[model samples]
Target chain A: MAERVRVRSMMPPGHVRTPAYLRGKVGEIERSLGAFPNPEELAYRQKATARPLYRVRFTMAEVWGAEAENPDDTLDAEIFAHWLIPLDD
Target chain B: MPHDHHDHDDFHHDGMSPSGHPYRADNDTPLTYWQVMEIAIRELLIDKGIATASEIAVQIDTMDARSPADGASVVARAWTDPDFKGRLLQDASAAARELGFDIGALRLIAVENTADIHNVVVCTLCSCYPRNLLGLPPDWYKTRAYRSRVVKEPRRVLAEFGLTLPLSTRVRVHDSTADMRYIVLPARPAGTESLSEEQLAALVTRDSMIGTGLPKSPA
Candidate 1:
């Protein structure tokens, strides 16, 4: 089974790279990209700690519910590992 | 064609702006805050020996040289060569570099369009485009309407661009929210089997790579 993860819904007002729309959304990991420097800290001129990145795939139905353009359609986005909370299947 | 020489009497006129617009601003039309900031930062950088004036000019020239044609050639090769296409799908940045485009730190992903699925690229967070491969993004791509509406109502938005996909074809939208950029590898138009790679490249329009339109069909 594919690993499940949820985007952490933390909304701090600063140089956040995670999109607010994807926050709180549950998605499946499409692929795990190797570690990269943190953009949030780098945006603040702070030392950027390397973190793993993952591309997550979410269905339109999962994102928009009844308002989904097409329930069968999908969306993908790259998220930092820090923003993702592993979900047990 | 550069009707854009600035008056050195008013301010230093290195003509660093790639837009080719004259930086000749009078008190009546003072330079914008960003223009002044860019000038200040660029001057400071040059003064501090961190970068040379000509190096900046050459960098701008390099950026200006990139266009959809670079991506078109890649697509044309992919259409003609299955092995290259496989490599492109697996690792886009390397594949683009194979064609001599110095994408420089751009993490690119090429999504293919097939009979079962269609892919579109957007950046709901901002205009996170594959500028390294496709040049600067279209102006409308940065508009709030496009960034907001496309993710939620892609079919409707794509229809506005005159693309009406069948329901059987699942629409997949990639939002380049962070760390990565996307390009749509559009399906080659039919009746183009006899066309040369260069000719095929000519048919791959910029909009097709963005997924707003399809590649030009043979006339």
Candidate 2:
């Protein structure tokens, strides 16, 4: 089988399952809860079971742009552990 | 070597459950006798020991708990705190946690609505709903017409729902695909300034959170 997809800090930049609206975006990691199976793997029924999941928070204007009324307010989302890679150059 | 059988037997596209009914399709389809038999076969697996009812029930329970009073608490905190509201607008899942709710395994996105812009969520593939936060998706949400037309012709679709935003109000459509889901946090309606959290939660109906209605005066 494929080598276990490493828990890397480098995230791929492109039209990934990660929302088109959220790519190239910066957000804080509110907390890191451990592994859960990646959705792509689960959907396709890949071998690995649980992988990690994280809750990343972003502002409304950050995602929606100037159209946001209360530009000061923010919104956060729970992303799977595998879905995110740490920010490293 | 004669290849072994890989179990494609259980795999199904999102458009239809294994039984061949469009999993979320609202329009009627006349089933042929053969197709009907195939559906019966698929359902029997569900009915028999192949898949337990408890598994489905577990999925339902997970969905229910994800959106329950925890949802109310998230909205309530937003009403009371500016800094937290700022965080919520920045990152919805984190915001949800601020109110002491853990989303667990489910993924969520908070779509914000404003004076000039309104937001709506649809799953073009299937009813990939925020089952946890919004309760069950309304029937119309799963319809083929709503899914196909919402993105291309939003104003017409909104009008069908008895929602006619000002021509000036820009409507943005968020299409949910696969695991990720969208939830709309509508602007608190005017004249609700003094309402208590319980009263405010009452005004914040599922439809309002989904962008089909606005937070309104208590009936």
Top lDDT model:
1
- Please state the interface RMSD for every predicted structure, separated by commas: 0.8, 7.2
Regions of candidate 1 where Cα sits further than 4 Å from its true position: B1-28
Poorly placed runs, candidate 2 (over 4 Å): A1-43, A46-89, B1-72
Q: Pick the candidate with the highest TM-score.
A: 1
DockQ of 2: 0.07
- Tell me the lDDT of model 1 at A7: 91
**Cα lDDT for residue A89, candidate 2:** 34
What TM value does model 1 have?
0.89
Q: Write the per-residue lDDT of candidate 2 for residues B14-127, one digit (tens) a residue.
A: 455546665555558888899999778767868887866677677768666665345555665677677877787767776776566646545676767888878877776678
Candidate 2: tens digits of C-alpha lDDT, residues A26-87: 66565554565566556666674675565465554565577654443444444555555565
Maximum-DockQ candidate: 1
